[model samples]
Target: MGKPISGSAADNSDVSFGLTLMAIAVLIAPLIDIFSKLAIATIPSGQITAIRFTLQVLFILPVVALRGALFDLTWKKTALHALRGVLLVATMLSFITTLKVMEVADAIAIFFVEPIILTILGSIFLKETIGWRRYTACGVGFFGAMLVVQPSMQEVGLIALLPIVSAFTLAVFLLVTRLVAQSEDPWSMQFHAGIWGALFSAALLYFGEGTGSDVFDPVVPDALSLVYVLGVGVAATISGVLGVYAYRAAPASVLAPLQYLEIVSATLFGWLVFNDLPDALKWLGISIIITSGLYIIWREHRLNKTAGTAPVSPAI
Candidate 1:
């Protein structure tokens, strides 16, 4: 047998740095979200979302202009994009509301149900076959999610449903993302989402204020807090870009469990930044979520291997 080959220095470096980038990006999400809550404390969730989308639009304007098809929306793609845009805005606003009210770790843990929902939807819509093992994994994951949220007894409230709504909306957004993947470029998708989000947020603001068209009001923000909001926007953008790169670099099986690392990061951020600690039940719940997610990924890889099929997307 030939001697085992060592990876080249560049290959090793690339792998190392790529993994680092993915991990850090996952961790950054909760931190950015915490800042979003601070921003939302002053501005309405609608306005916060509007500003975030506005910044994204401004940041991407030069590229969109160069691309030329910026506003060209094909009717079918426009409809799909609009649907996705509404889901995106709903997910953001609901999630922000959850963050404002709930513990960060709890919210993060509850949101872990997303992949489970996606798996079910994939089976239903994409005609993707899932084995009994994967189904069991999904079930276990959902149970763990409940443990994290611990919805039993009096803990359940009207607002408690927000995380579930956020997850469902986000799953729809992800489904649309899969559908639009072949047609939409990242910039165009972002542009569509931004414009739609801005429009919807403006409408919400108008309705909430009981006014006509004047939606946005520029108020002098508390200095440090304004800086924090900007920081959140920047961090979210960076994390979002990193997620795209991570998906490109690895299979979803490889990347999916790495996403569970966010729980660790969120736990730390919650404790240190917000003094929010996970309770025993919540911890137990998160453990379930982590195990289920890791198992689903492993089961997925095993299925692909046995069937001689390649992964659809790299781990994200």
Candidate 2:
């Protein structure tokens, strides 16, 4: 209704801070893949998933307590949180399993499809208006993912498809998160998700034990394995916290595209740590995925602007 304040000075600070934090979160996020890749050499991917959640709870517990919201949850919120936890397990298990054989950058590139999947699901479940353009972007994005998957599947067999599963599961997790996020404290939401994830994953590890399954069988962590698993938890905790605060500081449209930076981080880490690199075709696929994803973000921002609304920041 009124003229907006000038953004050339004061308004830039919060947005700038948010961008910086998001960049840091992006840069560090691949460390989770690095650790999972390392630890999965000896430990099962499911085991790594379990350790990550357990460590996340430990890492986040004090913060939740300090915020005086550790006990602030209702049955409904708890149930939703539990659902988030299950989806998180599915997401992480799929991701870590892929990390067992796939390059971190390639795996991350495929996972970028999550945003596109989210757009589709939002149209379906939220009954949000969607135009054909966004739908086209989603289709193109999947084509890019197929490019990445083509070579990966040839090299790694069906293991390459796991990131798609991860993406879909995470998309569902974010949907569940959307249901209760406005009514819950962010820290408590994270803490409760961690609690439920730890419980469910551990239970899975229990039931899946001794089935002779590489994905589900228990492998007790040795001393060095302990460090690797802790690394997974620590990286996840730090990136998660930074992301929460980043959204608090800036709008989703401004910060969403920056998430692609994780691919860069993952590629670099994969090279430095594991000597993995994407081939020329894989590079092309990665570029397409990033470009298509950015187009979707820009399209949504434009639509939200035309409608006089803000883009909803995702909590996943």
Candidate 3:
């Protein structure tokens, strides 16, 4: 008979599978930006955010039912899910708003600061230790994000700051996600979050529609626009599921750097769909941001190796 797999071997296998899932998530995530960009050509960002989450709830409900996970819900868990959903709505609203006025690649490049933000938040809120090297890398990553934002600021004005806000909210979202991840299945969490996000966005749409705020105004979508909205929903659902499971199976440090892959996908999609390309300076900033993020991941891995310790939760 073949020998049983060792515990460490099983763990390694899970990590490999998780990383594979993360890569898939990263690849598909850019589609949300692409579809949102297309949809918002006519649809308002608030409406788009509402439809995306409503569809996510519809898409994931059956999966949660099939998994027999609905009974796992508690008031506390439900409330936590709602709070996470609010943060996610903020993250999406900010990002999609940026996409409305900026190139997809540039907006995404600025949002890639999430990892750096995550590092700092992890150290503060999660009480994780960070050495000077990782701290310095975070600063470098922020500079790179600034580089991506500078040239476009003249045209987009304050809209360029939206992605930075997105990064901050996303970092907080992931931190909360880590806290609840162990108790809730990914499907259930996704379902509850979708419901809460849809409701929150609908409220925003209701309150802001006639308020002369262009970002919050509602617009009716034509048939083709409906297709774009549904595409954003589907892409977001897939990305959320994959991301939740990826973080569950692997350390955040292992998966955080891989998040950079989305920028490449975003750049490609932007060029193909919108004829948008980053300038040389923007490219330089992107390269630096990518480098800094990867260096932090590498430093964490080395430290963990030396200390013989596993990484902390939610690597971002």
Misplaced by over 4 Å in model 1 are: 1-17, 66-72, 151-156, 211-225, 305-316
**Model 2 weakest 10-residue run by lDDT:** 306-315
TM, every model: 0.84, 0.93, 0.89
Q: Residue by residue across 1-316, what tens digits does model 1's lDDT show?
A: 9766566765655556656767877878777677776676665566666667666666667777898859767888888888877887788778777776687778878877777777777789988899898799889988887776655323546565677678778877877877777776766777777777767776776666644222244344687767766766677677766776665565555566667777888788888878979778878888888788677777777777311111111111
- What is the model-wide C-alpha lDDT for candidate 1? 0.69
> What is the C-alpha lDDT profile of model 2 across 91-203, one tens digit per residue?
88898898888899999999889988888888899887889998998999999999999999999999899999989988888878778877889889888988888899899
Once fitted onto the true fold, the runs of candidate 2 whose alpha carbons sit more than 4 angstroms away are 1-8, 305-316
Number of the top lDDT candidate: 2
RMSD of each: 5.1, 4.0, 3.7
Q: Give lDDT per model, in order.
A: 0.69, 0.84, 0.82
Q: Across residues 106-221, which tens digit of lDDT does each residue of candidate 3 receive?
A: 98888877878988998999888999998999999999999999998987898999999988988888789778877888778778878888899999999998887767888778
lDDT-better candidate, 2 vs 3: 2
